[model samples]
Each structure stands twice: as structure tokens, then as C-alpha cells.
Target: MNTQLVESVIQLIRSLSPEEQAILQEKLFFDFAYPSTPDLITLALRGGSFEFLNDEPDLYSLTDGEPIPCP
Candidate 1:
């Protein structure tokens, strides 16, 4: 990797506003969480590791919680 390019990216991130930085943080988290390839959830389901969950009874109904009114 080019050292100058790495430093440029750091400078760009430092220039972001607080809100923009927060958004960037979330984007980084989500990229790590799901990844670019098939996600972990899909892999787990296909591997049948969590198939036992199908036997669990539903704990909550659709009407269980009060809905927040979105702006």
C-alpha cells in the first residue's frame, strides 16, 4: 500500500463533521458485520446450525409493543 494514500485517507476522515464521522463509523461497522460476500446469517441458516430455533414458541405478537410515530 502507498503510505501517502493512507495518510490522505486519514486526513479526509479527520475533516468530516461529527455527524459525518458518526455515519462513517456506522458504515464501517456494518461492512464488518455483514461483509461483501454472503453474510453470516445466510451461512448459518444454510448450515442448519440454528434449525433448533424453529421449535421455539413465538414470544411476541405483532401488537405487543406500542409503535413509535415516525416523523
Candidate 2:
């Protein structure tokens, strides 16, 4: 293990401006922050998790209900 090299790298990171540090941090941890998981809605659809919706009837329409009477 190169302890001196690690310490030098830490010092270099510390010298970066806040914005630069933020960019560096994101670059370092981007994989962990935004993993390659399927989108939630897509996963649900493709996995048949919402297959029950196929059995549900269309119970309401825009014109199905009576309009309210204005006083």
C-alpha cells in the first residue's frame, strides 16, 4: 500500500475549490449514486407487478358523472 501517495492525493483533493470538489466527488461516486437499475415504472410493468390492472374495468369517464348545479 502506498500510504504517501494516498496522502498526497488527499492533499490535492483538499486543494480543489468547492465546485471542483463536488464534481470530483460525483465522478468518484457516480456509480454508487446512480446505479444501473431499471426505472421503477418500467420494472413494475415488465415484471407483471401491475398485471392486476389488466383485470380492472374502466369504472369512470370524463362524462360519466353529473355536473354540479351552480347557485
Candidate 3:
């Protein structure tokens, strides 16, 4: 990913509270097993390797590749 984009993502994550950060990290790792959750937006912004489907407004779905599944 572009360095600028990565920086932007890091900045956005930093803006959230600690609890919100934890929730975002968890959702990024377990999107399929768990139902969609509040942190989906933040996860998408980070741009995992998987291809994402833009189902909801300003939201996306993992269409291809496995989600990174990390915290």
C-alpha cells in the first residue's frame, strides 16, 4: 500500500478510543465467523489483502483472498 495511505489509516485508528481500537482489530481478524460489527469501517480503511465488495454505503465486503486475521 502507499505510504501516505498507511499513514492516513494509522492516524484514523489513533483517533478512536482504546476500546474502539480493540473492537476494530478484532473485527479485522474475524469477519466471517462473527457477524458484521461496529469496526467494519475502520477495518476496511486499513485495506487488507482481500478484495472487498462494497455492499453498504461507505462499507465493503471481503470478496477474494483470506482476511489477514490479525489484531
Point to the candidate with the largest lDDT: 1
For TM-score, candidate 1 versus 3, the one ahead is 1
Tens digits of per-residue lDDT, candidate 2, 2-41, equal 9999999999999999999999998888956763566666
Better of 2 and 3 by TM-score: 2
Q: Cα lDDT of model 1 overall?
A: 0.88
TM-score for each of the candidates: 0.47, 0.50, 0.40
Candidate 3: C-alpha lDDT: 0.76
Scanning candidate 1 in windows of ten residues, the lowest lDDT window is 31-40
Clashing residue pairs, backbone N/CA/C < 3 A, model 2 = none
Q: Rank the candidates by TM-score, best first.
A: 2, 1, 3
Task: List the lowest-lDDT window of 10 residues for candidate 3.
Answer: 49-58
User: How does each model score on lDDT?
Assistant: 0.88, 0.87, 0.76
Q: Give the poorly placed runs of model 1, Cα more than 4 Å off.
A: 34-71
Per-residue alpha-carbon lDDT of candidate 1 for residues 1-71, written as tens digits (9 for 90 to 100): 79999999999999999999999999888767755555766788798988999999999899898888999
lDDT of 3 by residue, 1-71 (tens): 59999999999999999999999987888666764665676676676634544443644467855788788
> In model 2, which regions exceed 4 Å deviation?
1-6, 27-38, 62-71
